[model samples]
Target: MQQPAVPELAHTQTRPIHWVLTATAVAAVVALSTVARPGSATAAQSATGTRTTTAAVAPGTTGVQFPLDCGPVKALVVKKAGADLDGDGRPETVAVVHCDAPMGTPPDGVYVLTRSADGRRPRVVATLVRPEDRLTVTDFAVRARTVSATLLGYSSDAVPSCCPDLRTPAAWQWNGSAFIRSTGSAHSV
Candidate 1:
């Protein structure tokens, strides 16, 4: 007797469906756990009166009230560099604030916040670089009251709109009045 023609079941296998459903159910459980179910971040935040993230710091700080309670804020970072840039005794704050850009571009601003000699009223000492779309400052460092940034896409055709290649470095030093371009290399932080 001739063997009956058997279609290959590789493409139409039914066991794979079972595995996929199982994986999906596992993922759903994990996702549900992260929500405000019981012991999640949302629940902990609600239990506490104060916002759990960055609180208003002590005196002489930039007072960066990270309002995490409202929701997930975008690209706004505050790096408290303990270096006393400008030869002041107090440390300065370096903040990367988000800038307006086109839909595909990512632009941000770097601000050097300095406090008065009275140790209060922190104000922006120098805006190292103004906000421009498609430009990126990958990393920054302060040495001898100087600021150098690992910048990308500031020049013409340096990087793409979204994915920036942070290879080129730029330096900015305080010229007694403002942060001027200086000579230095930016290392990845």
Candidate 2:
């Protein structure tokens, strides 16, 4: 005996998969924008851990303490300088000095700590080598979209004591997602 014909489901009765997908995409965009917004208090708090010290630097100054693991080496000076190379009023520079000797010899490179936007603390962004070919970092600069570092080196031989003019400058620019080499500049010594 032939079985009864099965009933076909109507398209209108089915769940709208496209609607669900569109809703999910919209939610994801909203969530990403909310988390990516700059200067968000929540974002800053999440990036850095809890605050430990309440020492006031100034009348209206507030600061946060984060873990800094630099081993035994000490940083000589930490100061604020113009980071925004374009003169946009946004601080993109983190200048630091270290007396630590370079791995090679007498002339050690000065370590420059580059800080993020918040400017709470800094990390070793680059090194400037001395003019003696001793590999010491003398000066450096950081901008919102790029980081430029210069290294000076000199020869100690009797060959006229040539400095060689080894600029050894390196730069990186923000490429929408991450910092990448904007030009054909070499990133090595």
Candidate 3:
């Protein structure tokens, strides 16, 4: 066999000390990695520099007396969505309520609810859709300080209550003073 170009060095031989040194180097790297870590996460908004340790609870629909008068039957909340509709840190609830009628389709009243000054109860802040409008609320949602819904209504008085003939997509956004409604053109359903 031809002689190799380089001679074997002493370090090339495997020994117990070499194994111990390798293990020590690996252990040191692991220990140092454990000591160096990222800081604890925080729930804070960078824009407002507000630190929210606990989540803000939205206003609840229970016990809230909506502006609608349901007579003997109680007013029922059909759907609800919560968000910061007024740019406040606290969340407000947008509720779709109607009379708990035994039969026939009842008109829905979309109301914005906020916590009272004493935080004792949720009060109606604005009425997006009044019951008198005779409209049913569907595909409802509250996002980015806006309330959106698809309103179902009758095109004329001849249309039966069981089936709505007109469908309109509507959205309400807070304009600092009031919630401005932007309604899409109605279409027959």
Candidate 4:
């Protein structure tokens, strides 16, 4: 074979010192990466100059005594969604509850649950749907501090209890003092 045009470079030739230097550089990079790290960030700062990163836990529906009076049957939470509804940092839970009956469809009652002043237990703050309304809740959700749901009900007294003929889309939002309800046109199911 013909001789190469350029001579071999020093780096191309591997020596014992080259291996030791390459290992040292890799070790230094790892050591520096582990030693230097960014600090944790705080979500909000208070007037007292204290930083808080902990978020308030959303209220749970369990053990909450709703305003509904279920004499023999216990109230069961069929659906629930949690969010910061009233612009408060703490989150509130909107629960769809109904009496656990052995047979037949039970009317659902929608209640907004929040933690008590002591943050010990959840309490019903608002009632969006009453069991007396004879409406069943469907597609229930809480998004962007607004509660939206499709309510199913009977068009008239003659309508069978098992079948709801009317379907209405409803939404509720906190207007400072109370929850304001807005509903869409009712249509036959």
- Best candidate according to lDDT: 4
**Model 3 misses residue 156 by how many Å?**
1.1
Compute the lDDT for candidate 4: 0.92
Rank order (by TM-score, best first):
4, 3, 1, 2
lDDT values for all models: 0.57, 0.43, 0.91, 0.92
Give per-model TM-scores.
0.48, 0.31, 0.72, 0.74
Tens digit of lDDT per residue, candidate 3, span 3-98? 889997778789998999999999999999999997643236666786666567787899998999899999999899989888877788999999
lDDT of 1 at 7: 60
Best by TM-score: 4
Tens-digit lDDT track of model 2 for 31-80: 99988975423112233686533322211111322123335654334323
Report the CA-based lDDT of candidate 1 relative to the real structure. Answer: 0.57
What lDDT tens digits, residue by residue, belong to model 1 across residues 81-151?
53556553345676665533335554657777765566457766666656644456767776776676776
Clashing pairs in 4: none
Cα deviation at 10, candidate 2, in Å, is: 99
By lDDT, is 2 or 4 better?
A: 4
Candidate 1's displacement at residue 141, Å, is: 1.6
lDDT: the better of candidates 2 and 3: 3
Q: What is the Å distance of residue 64 in model 1 from its true position?
A: 5.3
Tens digits of per-residue lDDT for model 4 on 1-189? 988999877688789998999999999999999999976432477899986866667888878899888899999999998899999777899999999999999999999999898778999999999999999999999999999999999989999999999999999999999999999999999
